[model samples]
Target: MFKINNLSAGIGGKTILKEISLDIKPGQVHAIMGPNGSGKSTMAGVISGNDNYEVTAGELLFDGKDIKDLDPEERACMGVFLAFQYPVSIAGVNNMVFLQASINSIRKYKGLPPLDAFDLIELIKSKMKLINMNPDLLQRGLNDGFSGGEKKRNEILQMLCLEPKLVILDETDSGLDIDAMKAVADGVNAIRDDQRSFIVVTHYQRLLDYIKPDVVHILKDGEIVMSGDYKLALKLEKEGYGWLS
Candidate 1:
């Protein structure tokens, strides 16, 4: 569903990712593992169309169309969802309000009728249950005063609600306890279907223990140094990146 061909991107005229290429097929989960400053998150950012970075060479294609020129919102509307590494707090925006607006915006982009209040409420309730989220969270400001686990679960809830074709989760396991990680992983696994694809970027193999990626890629210095199945993650856990270096 998504393909990156020799994509080199950077911010402020400094290259961060150099000739990175990847192919994510439908219903497959791909895990990207790397040490800090290895361009893991930079790959995610560039794919989601973060304007801070500029692509100096190569292409990013989604569903057979080149998306280099598309804005972030446009990429989102086209079924690309990037769950942030650090979810920012919106102090005044109600969670349900934000979700409704986001969903409706995507719907409108696809020429579909907007969901009414009743339908939206039902949808939110159903998706919230998937992640075991508290209903009270919907009434609170987005990510405001939420615990770390709560914030991560909230991100999973948004992913479930949005139903993006390609889900890019950047460190969704960071700061999460084992139970919280399992819950978040369960939510991700629940949403997996024949038409959906996922790119999971994480540092540790613990997250892979729960999510079980079909493909594991070791990214270092802005490029993928190695790619394999789930066993690669386990190897990294035991041997570390030094073995590959």
Candidate 2:
């Protein structure tokens, strides 16, 4: 459902991704593992149409059409979601209200009527239950003073509400405890279907232990040096990235 061919992207005048090529089929989970500064987040940013980066070369295609020109909101409305490595805390912004507005906006974009307050609340409560989340969180500010695990769960909550076709989780397991990580993985696993695809970028294989990927790619210096099945993640878990260089 997503394809990148000879794609090079960067910020300012520095190119981070060099001729990166990938073909992700529907219902596939592709895990990208790499060292710091390997452009994992940059690639995610570029794919989600972050304006900070510039695409100097190649194609960023979603469903065979280039998405480099689309804005981040456009991509989100088109079934693309990115969970950031560091979730921002917006003070004084009620999370429930914010989520409702965001979901209704996407619905409007799709020419669907906005859901009523009761229906929206019930839907959110149901999703929160799916991830074992505390519904009281809906009353708090958006990630305001939330623990790392809460913030990550909020991202997954958005995923459940948005129901996007392409989900990019950028280190969703970072700073999470074992139980928290499992909860997040369960939320992700619950949403997996034949039409949805995932690009899970992480520094460890432990996350893959719960959300197994169909393919694993080791990225070094902004290039994919190796690609294999789940065994690649296992090997990297046993032996670190030093062996690849």
Candidate 3:
């Protein structure tokens, strides 16, 4: 469902990704493991059409259409979701309003009618249960005054509601306690379907223990150095990224 072909992206004038190519089929889970500054997060940013990075070369195809020049909102509308490494706090926007608007935008893009208030409420409630999110948080401002774990849970809640075709999570497990981590994993797994896929970017293998990846790619410097099965994550956990390099 997602294909990156010879993709190289950078910020300012410095290139971070070097001829990076990978394919994630529908229903497959791929984990990207890399040390800091290895361009793992950059890949996520580029794929999601983050304007901060300029693509020096290559093309990205989402569902067979080139998306290299698509904006971030456009990508999200095309069933692409990025669970950010650091969840941002929108001080004034209420979480419920933000999510409902997001859903409406996506539906409009797909030529579908917007959800009614009752339908949206029911949808949010169902997704909240799936993600183990407190319904009370929905009434609050987006991420304002939320705890670290709460921010992460909120990200997962957004993911569940969006139901993206390809979900790219950048450090979703960072700053999450064991219980919170499990909740995120469960939410992700619940969304797994024949038309959905995941690309989880993480430093530690602990999160992979809960969300088992079909393939693991070890990224280094600015490229993927090695690709292996789930066992590779275990090896890296024991030996560290230094050995892989």
TM-score, one value per model: 0.98, 0.98, 0.98
The residue pairs found clashing in candidate 1 are none
Deviation from native of the Cα of residue 237 in model 2, angstroms: 1.0
lDDT of 1 by residue, 27-96 (tens): 9999999999999999989999989999999988899999998999999999999989999999999999
Off by over 4 Å in 2: none
Worst 10 residues of 1 by lDDT: 124-133
Cα lDDT of model 3 by residue, 97-180, tens digit: 999999999999999999999999999899888767888899989999989988999999989888899999999999999999
Q: Per-residue error at 152 for model 1, in Å?
A: 1.1
- For model 2, how does the per-residue alpha-carbon lDDT over 70-122 read when each residue is reduced to its tens digit? 98999999999999999899989999999999999999999999999999999
Candidate 3: stretches off by over 4 Å: none
TM-score of 1: 0.98
Clashes within 3 Å, all models in order:
0, 0, 0
For residue 67, model 1's alpha carbon misses the true position, in angstroms, by: 0.5
> Using lDDT as the measure, what is the rank order of every candidate, best first?
2, 1, 3
